[model samples]
Each structure stands twice: as structure tokens, then as C-alpha cells.
Target: MRKLLLLLVCPLLLSAQTPADQILAKAKAYHDPQDIWPTLETTFTFKETRPDGPDRSTIIILDNGISYMKINRNDEEVYEVNGEVAEVLKGDKDKARALVLRNYYLYLWGLPMKLYDKSTPEISLAEDEKVGDKLCKVLRVVYEEDTWYFYIDDFSGRMLQYKFYKDEATGKGELITLEDEIMVDGIKIPQERSWYTLPEMKYLGTDILEEVD
Candidate 1:
């Protein structure tokens, strides 16, 4: 009886020995089919809609190395990120703040898409969890002195959810959750993001992206 049990479990164990690093490589190859991610500065438009209101604007932006972003909504200015205030031509403080928030939100939620090339310490297989009905292998990641939890589907190896625990400096810091599915260049990507902050509040947003040349 004992021998039979060992025989039954041996293959399952060996087949499931996928580390987080290996899974990440496979995921990048599968998810980023069209290579739309920005490696350098680029400007493209986006249509943003909220339940309370809807708006269409030209999302002019720069993504220099290190994720520096400068976004202009139509002829009006609304966003900037990691940019020097002296360099900006806009004088509206409200627009600057909006730009900064936009940049921060976009950058945080748009990751795993951006985590395409980064490699860090690889951890052994942790556990398995289900994000939807799909079974995923949960992996723990520590980057930038911050800890994060990720779930990647077993077969497809695509990242399903990325949860980041904010550092202690901001006593009111919180957790970031990225979810949902968005199709980009025919590839499904993360579309919904729930930014859970301290004081028991959350900023929930969704990005329904359509790929345009």
C-alpha cells in the first residue's frame, strides 16, 4: 500500500517542480505576443470612462527609462510622473497633481506587463491558489525592499494577480491588487485594478484597452 502511494505521487511532484523564475519566463513569452510594451519613450492615445462620467482624450506620454511619464490630455495638461517640476511647461498645480496620480496608478497596475524582463532571486514553489476558476501557482516575490504575492496559472503560466504590500513609511499605506482580463493585440492582459489603501478605503478602476496601431 505504501509503495503504491509513493508511485502515484512521484510523477505529480516532479511535474510540478516549477519555480517562480521559470514560470515568469514562460509567462512573458506567452502573454506579450505583439510586443506592445514600451522600452523607451512613446505616445499613444487612450479612451477613459468612469461610471459617473466618460471622457476621451489623447494620452500623450513619455516613458523614458525608469518609468518617467508626462501625459497630456487633449490640448489640456493633466498628468506627469517622476518628472522634474522645472522641466514642465504647465503651470496648473491641479493638473500636475492629477498627472502624478495618473502616472502612479498606471505604473503600478501596468506591471507584470512591465515585469517582462526583470529577474530576481528565485524562490522554490510555494503553494497553489485559484484566482478565478483557473488553478494558479502562488509565488512570493520580494523586490525593491518590498514584498509582493503573485499567482500564475499552471498551464498558461500567465500572471493573474499581483498583490503588493506597501512599506511602513506611510503609516496609512495599503495593499495593491491587480486583476481582470484585457485584450491587447489579441492577447489578454490584466484590466481591473483595486488599490486598497489605509483608513479602510480603496480606489477601484478598470482599463478596457483596445489595441490601435
Candidate 2:
């Protein structure tokens, strides 16, 4: 009876240790070891640089526990969204745009921690691949409209790059590469995010985290 019990438990353990689960767990441990991101409240100031235009600075405040976010662009109040209500303080009163910004900022910064959310899309593992010269483990997440692939450093488990595609067959989308990091509110946030066109690999823009308070 003891031998049978051991045999049953071994398969359960092996099955539970999936490649996707292992990669995500390692990444979450590196980024937010204390698991403090879900209730995190903080401010981040960053600059967006592009070859085609002048640099722009933006400030974003996020309080996830209360589902609140506010964005300021170029020293002007852009919008703030609290729960279901969006207050547009500048520019056109577009509630949808405000809400989109709220989600985009929160999700992009939250990263591996956000992947743990129950409402997040399904996640699976792809074969090991290389981004640049670093060997990475790929995590494929399927959303409602598009699919995203995240590449995590094989050794350190840090997120190195990610790409999104509306249609995988077309191979037309953008790839965002993460570099450097900053520790803010006990969370390891990427300092530079460089964007490039997929396939063509044309340089687009980069967002650099300038300060956090």
C-alpha cells in the first residue's frame, strides 16, 4: 500500500511542476518576492523617446487595491479613472481612452505579478527560444483579440522581451524589449522598454523610467 501511494504522489508532483508554472513562479519571485504588488500603490515618472518626435514625459499613479489610476502627460493632467468612473481633466472627454490608459499602464508595469491574476488570460509554455543572444523561456498568453508572447531569461527568470500579434500568420506586430530595472515599493520594475517592429525589426520608440516616488 505504501509503494502504491508513493507512485501516485510522484506523478502528481511532476504534473504540477509544469514548464509555464515554473517559469512564472521564478519570475514572480525575482520581481516581487514579498508578493506586495496586488495592493501596491505608487507613482512612476517616465520619458518616452522616439526618433520621429520630441521626447515626452509622463507621470502615472496607480493604486490597485482601490482600482484607481491617474496619468499626467507633459505637465498636464490627462485623465484619472476611479473604479468605473473616468474623469477626463484635459483634452477631449473620452472615457474609453482614459480607461484604456488605466489598464495599459497598470498591466504593463505589473508584469509577472499581473499574470497571477485570476482574470488574466490563459498561459502556456512554448519551446525555449533566444531573444537577442540570451536563451529565454517563452510564455504564451492568449487574450480576447490578440496573443502575446513573453520571453524570460533562462537563468535569472527575468522578463527580457515580449511581443503581441493580432494575427500570428501575418507576423505583423511590435516587440518590446526590457532592459535594466529599478526597485520601487519593493517591486523590480523595468527601467527601459524599447519597442521595435516585428519581422522588420525597425526601431520605433523607447520608454525610460526616470523616477519613482
lDDT of 2: 0.89
lDDT of each: 0.58, 0.89
- Cα lDDT of model 2 by residue, 183-209, tens digit: 988889899999999879999999999
lDDT of 1 at 168: 43
Off by over 4 Å in 1: 1-18, 34-69, 73-86, 91-106, 116-125, 167-187, 197-213
TM-scores for the candidates:
0.56, 0.90
Best by lDDT: 2
- List model 1 lDDT by residue over 1-213, tens digit each: 999999999988767766665676566666665555554445545555444566545464656465566666555655556644413445456645665655554555355555543454455456787876889876676667666666778888777665555564554555445555655544455654454555465654444333323
**Could you tell me which 10 consecutive residues in candidate 1 have the lowest summed lDDT?**
204-213
